[model samples]
Target: MVLIKDVGSEKDKKLSVSEYIKLLNNSLSNLYGEVIGEISEITISAKGHVYFVLKDKITGYVLPCTIWETNYLLNGIDMEIGMEILIKGRPEFYGPFGKLSFITKNVELVGDGALKKAYEKLKEKLEKEGLFDNSRKKTLPLFPKKIAVITSNYGAVIHDFTNNLRKSGFQIKILDCRVEGSESGPELALSVRALRGEDIDLLVIIRGGGSIQSLAGFNNEALVREIANFPTPVIIGVGHHEDVTLASLVADASESTPSLTAELIGRSWEKAEQSVDNIQRKIFSHYEYSLERSSKILRLTFEKAKKSFDKILKIHDNTKQSLRHGMQKIKEKIKETQNGVSDKKIYITQQFQKSIDEVNNKCLFNIPKFILKKYTKIIKDKQDSLKTLKKLIETNNPERQLELGY
Candidate 1:
C-alpha cells in the first residue's frame, strides 16, 4: 500500500543543491533530541520568531537555533546571554542561505537557579497583572454534575482521578492529549479552547507529579491565559506539592494531585448526601416519637373509658336490687289487701319490668357503642395525622424529588 524511499541506497547519485538539502533535512529529522547549552546570542524578529546561538558549556561549540513565535511565547522564558537552556528540535537546512539551523519546538531553562528565576519572574508579572487575585477567581459550583477533564489518556493519572471520585452520578467528559514534552503546551491550550461552550459545569485539568522541567507545559503563558479566561470554572491539579505551575495559579482552583482534585469536585455532593441522611434519621426519629405518644394516649383513653363503664354497671345493679325489694314488699301488701289491689299490682310489675329492660339495653348496647365510636374516631384522627405527616416528609424528600425528575 505504501512505498519506502531508500535515499541512502545511492551514495554516488548526483542531485541538485535543493534536492541535496531536502535529503539532508530528511536525515536531520530523525536526529531530534534535547540539547543543553548556554545562550551566547539572542534576537527576536519583528514577526516574533526567535533566533539564538547556544554554545556548549563544556566544549565551547556553538549552534544556531530558531523557534517560531508561537512556540517561543508558549514557553514564556526570557532569553539572555550566559543563561543555560535546553532546546528540543531537529536541524533544518536553508538552501538559499546555505545554512543549517536547529528548529526548536520547545525551550526550557536548564539549571534549578535559572528555572527558579524564570518562574519567579513570570509569577511576579502575572500576579501584578491580577491574574492570581482571589477576587478574580471564579467559584466552583457547589454541586457540579457535569465535568470536563483534560489530561493525558496514557498514564495512571486518569485512573487515579476516576477511582478517587465518588459514584455521585456525575457526567464526565475526558479529552485525551499529551501532558508532557515540547508539544504538550499547545496541545493543552487547544484542548481547553476546544471545550469552550460545552455543556459542562466544571473544567478540570490534571496530571501526576513531576519536576519543574517535566511540568513545564503547565507553566506555559498561553495555557495560563486560556485557563484564566475560560468561561467555566477551571481546576488544575498538576505537579508535586511544592511545584505550583503558572496555569494552576491562574485557575479557579488548584490541587496537588489528581485524586485530590476529584475529592474537591465531589465534596459538595458528599456533604449534601450526609445532610440528607441526617435529615432522614431525624424525621424517622420524630415520626417514631409521635407514634409512641399517640399509642400512649390511646391506651390511657381506653383505661379511663373502662373505669367509667364499670362504675355505670355497678350503679345499674344497685338500682335493680332496690326495684326488686320494692316489688316484693308491694306484692306482700297486695296479697294482704286481696281482690281490690290486683290491677295495681300488675301495673306496678309491668312498669318495673320495662325500666329493667331499658337499663339492660343502655348498659349492654348504647354504652359500649358510644365508647367504640369515640375510640374509633380517635384512631381515625391519629391515622389521618400520620398520613399528613408522611405526605409532608415525602414532599420534602430530596431523593424522592430526584426520582420524580426534579
Candidate 2:
C-alpha cells in the first residue's frame, strides 16, 4: 500500500500497488518529449514490440526504452545495436515487471547520415515490394470535382494550394493536421483513413519545403502504404525540388510544390475549355464557307432562270407577229375572190340578155307557132338553171359562213 494525495478527492488516500502505478503513469504522460542517444541493446518480442537501451556516449548514462509494434514498424527504421536514434515518448512503470520504461510513440534516426541510410534502406525495401511501381499507381480522374486534402493548417502550405486552385466548381475537404514532427505521421495516416468512406474524387497530401529531418514524417512506412493503397487517386506535393519523400514516391502523382498540384488538378479543365473554343471556331468557319457557297449557287441559278424566261418571251412575240401577218393575208385573199365572183356574174347576165333578144327576133318571124313555143320553153329553163347556180354559190361563200359565226 502507498499513501498519496488524490487530486480528484482533495485528500490523502491509501492506494494499492496497481493504483499507485496507474497514478505514476498518468503523471509520467505529462513528461513526454524527445530523447536522443546511441542504441546499446535491442530486442523484439513475439508480439513485435521493440525493447531497446539508449546510452549517452559522453556521460555513459543509459535509459531503457520500449515502443509498440505499430509505432516501431511505422518509423521504418531497423534497430541495430550501435546505431544512434531519437525516440519521442514518455516514461511508464510496468506493473507486472516492476520496471520503469520509456514508452516510445515515435522513433527516428539521429543524424543526417543515419537518416539517409534508413531512407535508402526503406526505399529499397518498398521498391522491391512494388509499391513504387508505375503499374500499381492509380490514374488521376480526368475531371475531379471533389477533393480531400490532408496537410498542416498552421502554415502556408494550405494557403498556397488553395490560392492556386481554381475558384469555382470544386468541393475541397481539408483535414488540418501537423505536417512535421513525430505526431504528424500517425495523424496523416488517420486523416487518410478518415476519408475512407467519403465521397471524394481525389486525395491530396501537401506540405511546404523542409529539410530531410523535417520531412521524415512523409517517409513514414505506414503513411506510404496508406497512400499507395488508397481507394482514390492520391497526389503528394511535399518539400522542395531537392526533396522526394517516400509518400510522394508511392503516390499516384507527385509534384514539387503545392501550387503545382493545384495546377495539375485544373489542367484538364483548362484543356477542355481550349478544345471547346477550337471546335466553336471550326464550326463557325464551316458555316461561313457553306453559306457563301450556297449564295453563289443561288445567284447563278437565278441568272439562268431569268435568261431562260427572256428567251421564251422573245420566241412568243415572234410567233404572234407571224400569226398576225398570216391572218391578214387570208382575209385579203377571201375579199379578192368575192370581188371576182361579182364581176363574172354581171358579164354573164349581160351576154344572156343579148342572146335572148336575138332569139326572139329570128324565131318569131320565120317559124310556126309550135316552133316558137318550144324556143320559149328552152330559154325559160336556161334562165332558171342560171338562178340555181347563183344561189348555190351564195350559200357556199366563206364570207357568208363568217357572218353566221362559223
Candidate 3:
C-alpha cells in the first residue's frame, strides 16, 4: 500500500503558470499515489518513456500516465493497451503542455481477472501474427541425449519427471527457477538465456499443478517470447488441463504432466525398439518357411528318382527273360529241322544272339546311365536354388544390414 499526501490545502491558490505547476507538484507530492484502471491507450517514445491513458471501469474517468524508461523496466510489467493494471505514483502538472499527468513510480498487474484480460489481448495479437502456427514449431529429435530442464528443483514435478523417463542414457541438466508469481518473468528469462548457448538437444520446463494465480507466470509475455525464439525446441508441462498458457502455445511440444512430457521425449527410442522386434520376428518366420519348403522339395525329388530307378530295373529284367525264352524256342526249332538245313539254323541262331547282345548293352549300361544323369541334374538344380535362397535371406537380414551401416 502507498501513502496518500494532502493535495487539498493548495488547491485554491492562484499563481503564474510555472508557479502554479510548482505549487501543485509540492502539494500533490504523494497524492493520487495509487490508481487502478484499464489502459485505454499507450504511446512509447524514442527515448523509452511510456505515455498511456488509464480509464476507470465504473466512472468512465481517464487519467494520463507517464512512466520513465527506468521505472518502466523496474516495474517488470509488459504493459499493453486495454490491460487493467495497478500503478503507484503522484500527480504532476506539466507547465509547458498545460496538462496534468500521473508520474508512475511502480506498476504491476492486478488480479487474475486483469491478467486474464491481458492474456486474451496478447493471445489475439500473437495468433494474428502467426506465432502459434504449427509450421513454425520445431520437431523434437528422436533420441535427445542432453536435455535442459527449467523448473523448481524442490518440487515433486522434477522427481516425477526423472522417475518417468525410461531412457537411462539421457543427460538431464536442471536449472531451478521460480514457477509462480511475477518473479517467474525475470527468472525464466535468465534461464532461457543461460541455456541458449548450451549443447543441449531439447529444453523442458515443468511444474506441479497450481491455481490460476500461481500458474499465471506461465502466461507471461516475456517467457512466451523467449520460448518462441529459443535456440532449441521447448517442451512445457505446467500441468493445467483447462487452460493453455501462451508459452505452451509457442513451444515445440506441450503436455499436461511431467510424466507425459518424459514419455514424449522418449517416444523415438521406444518406437525404434518395437521396429527391431518386428523385424526380428519377420526374419525368423521367413527363415523357417525357407527351410521347410526346401526339405519338402528334396524329399519329393528323392522319391521320384527312386521310382525311376525301379522302373528301369524292371524293364532290364523283362528284356533278359524274353531273350532266354526266344533262345529256348530257337533250340527246339533247330533240333526238329536238324535233318532239313543245318546252315539256315546256324545263321538264324547267330542273328538272334547279335540282337540279344545289343539289347543287353543298351538296357544294362545306357539306360541306367541316362536315368542317373537326369536325376543328378535335377538334384543339382534344386541345390543351387536353395543356395540362392539362402543368400537372398542373408542379404535381406536386418541385423546384417545394420552391421554394414545400412
The lDDT of each candidate is: 0.83, 0.87, 0.80
Task: Identify the leading candidate in terms of lDDT.
Answer: 2
**TM-score of each model, paired residue for residue:** 0.73, 0.83, 0.56
Question: What is the C-alpha RMSD, rounded to one decimal, of candidate 3?
Answer: 26.4
Return the lDDT, model 1, position 331.
63
TM-score of 3: 0.56
Model 1, residue 393: distance off in Å is: 83
Q: What is candidate 1's lDDT per residue for 1-406, written digit by digit as tens?
A: 2233557884456567777778779999999888999999999999999999999888899999999998887766778899888888999997788988999987877766777787788899899999999999998999999999999889899999999999999999999988884358877888898999899999999999887667877877778888988999999988653658889889999999999999999999899999999999999999999999999999999999999999999998999999999878766664555443445545655775576566566653655787767755875786577567656755765444545764
Candidate 3 stretches with Cα past 4 Å from truth are 1-76, 80-108, 308-406
User: Which ranges of candidate 1 are over 4 A from the true structure?
Assistant: 1-24, 58-60, 95-98, 180-183, 239-243, 339-406
The model with the greatest TM-score is 2
Candidate 3 lDDT at 214 equals 68
Ranking by TM-score: 2, 1, 3
Note the residue pairs that clash in candidate 3: none
- Tens digits of per-residue lDDT, candidate 2, 1-406, equal 8988779988999999998899889999999889889999999999999999999999999999999998876666788999998888899999999998999987878877887787888899999999999999998999999999998788788899999998659999998888885457777877887888899999999998887888878878888888877899999988643548989999999898999999999999999988999999999999999999999999999999999999998888988988998878877777787888878888898999987778666656787788878887887898899899899878877778767876
Residue 178 lDDT, candidate 1, scale 0-100 = 84
